[model samples]
Target: MPTETPRPMRRQILTFAVVGVINTATYYGFYLLFLIALPYLGAHVLAFLLSMTGSFFLNARFTYRTRPTWRKFLLFPLTNAANFLITTAGVYVIVGVLHHGSRFAPLGASMAAIPVTFVVSRWIMVPKAGTA
Candidate 1:
């Protein structure tokens, strides 16, 4: 007989996906709002930071079901740094190099970073048996 997948893992993945959608929307909204006032890169950075803040809470409460902590909050940016770097570079390349529209470049670039972000975020949010 074939082995079955774990329920907890499945739930976590589903929750993470849901949270990702919400985060993306939140980020895009902020990006659009900021685009009117700032350049595309500036808008992307500000929007990413704001959405990341909201993502911490949502991922903690909904995806990982972990308790929020000052430590985790502070460390959360580390998880996002990879995503930030990748997406920022991607946006730059897509817009500056390829001459894509600034408004939509971030949305296109960010998709590539999502899986890495999810994995890093899960590692950060979920506590080990002895660590929690």
Candidate 2:
């Protein structure tokens, strides 16, 4: 269960969006930094990892208003598993098939994954009220 009654759905969704914007910037920043040395795919993976760590705390503290715990921290990555897979495949297609620049391609790749990520994140973060 969450530490308190969860915020209303509208509010939670809005908060989630706020956190997501912050996470996106963090992800992009790491991606650009890693791109200096790593290949595109490698940069994406490393950046995803780093950004996800920040996302876990932000989503726990703000969006879900829940305390971070070892179990929740461990579980949080699952929320992004689908997102990661979608973006990875999308990135590969965008770069390899579509011949797009790797720099902005991840942003496009990530768009399709957002709804799924939100659902999984809510399920993991809110626990008891997740499915309501």
Candidate 3:
């Protein structure tokens, strides 16, 4: 009988952070492109949704090394519920309330939500112990 090695939390965190960087770059590129045709909030929402779709796959494949399933995919957005709320508020505060530009608002907004996102995403993407 073979025993599986335990996965390291530190390694998983590092992988998640790398995936985040890639997702952020992808999101930023889309946000900038969308800004050309839409308002900041509109562009933000569209870009956010699109990048989130990509993020799901990236996290599944690399960060967690889990198979992507419809159940998980459906629940994936819940992982970002806090992230979305936090970043949206942060962006609003920075860009609307503080008079900053849309271009950099999301980058700043995204920082605070990382820890929460990691926790929630892991819960949502990975099956519970003794199950699945």
Candidate 4:
């Protein structure tokens, strides 16, 4: 268990959304920067890693109101991997395989992955009270 006290689920959800907004901003900021500064795939990977770090810290401390622990920390990267694969596969299916890389295509596909990532990240990356 970590030092931080846990908040209620509703408050936790709100906090999670707030942190998500910040993390999304960070992800996109880095994404746009990477597009301008780095090459293809490099930009996406770099931004994804950086933004994931932000999400882990924010969600752990603020959203879930839990202290950092080895289990939680270790689980963070794995949750990120889940998010990355889900996001990538979604984007690829829409943009690459489906040939629907237009305005609504990416949005439609990405919508499928967001809730899944949130649920998994919430359950996996945050510590529960009185657990091992």
lDDT of each: 0.89, 0.93, 0.91, 0.69
Off by over 4 Å in 2: 1-7
Candidates 1 and 3 compared: the better one by lDDT is 3
What local lDDT does model 3 show for residue 48? 95
Q: What is the alpha-carbon lDDT for the whole of candidate 4?
A: 0.69
- Please give the RMSD of candidate 2 to the true structure: 4.8
TM-score of 2: 0.93
Q: TM-score per candidate, in order?
A: 0.92, 0.93, 0.91, 0.73
Clashing pairs counted in every model:
0, 0, 0, 0
- Per-residue lDDT tens digits for candidate 2, residues 1-132, read 657644587788898899999999999999999999999999999999999999999999988889999999999999999999999999999999999999999999999999999999989988887656
Error of 1 at 21 (Å): 0.5
Clashing residue pairs in candidate 3 (N, C-alpha, C atoms within 3 angstroms)? none
Q: Which segments of model 3 are wrong by more than 4 Å?
A: 1-7, 129-132
Q: Which ten residues in a row have the lowest lDDT in candidate 1?
A: 123-132
At residue 15, what lDDT does model 3 achieve?
A: 93
lDDT (10s digit) by residue, model 3, range 25-125: 99999999999999998888999999999999999998888999999899999989899999999989999999988899999999999999998888887
- Candidate 4 local lDDT, 1-132, one digit each (tens): 777544576787688778877877787678678777675346667977898887888888887767878787777887667667776677567767887733343234445566666667777855452243
- Kindly list the per-residue Cα lDDT of model 1 for residues 1-132, writing each as its tens digit: 998858987898899899989999999999999999999999999999999999999999998999999999998998799899999999999999999889888888888888888777877887572253
TM-score, structure 4 vs. true: 0.73
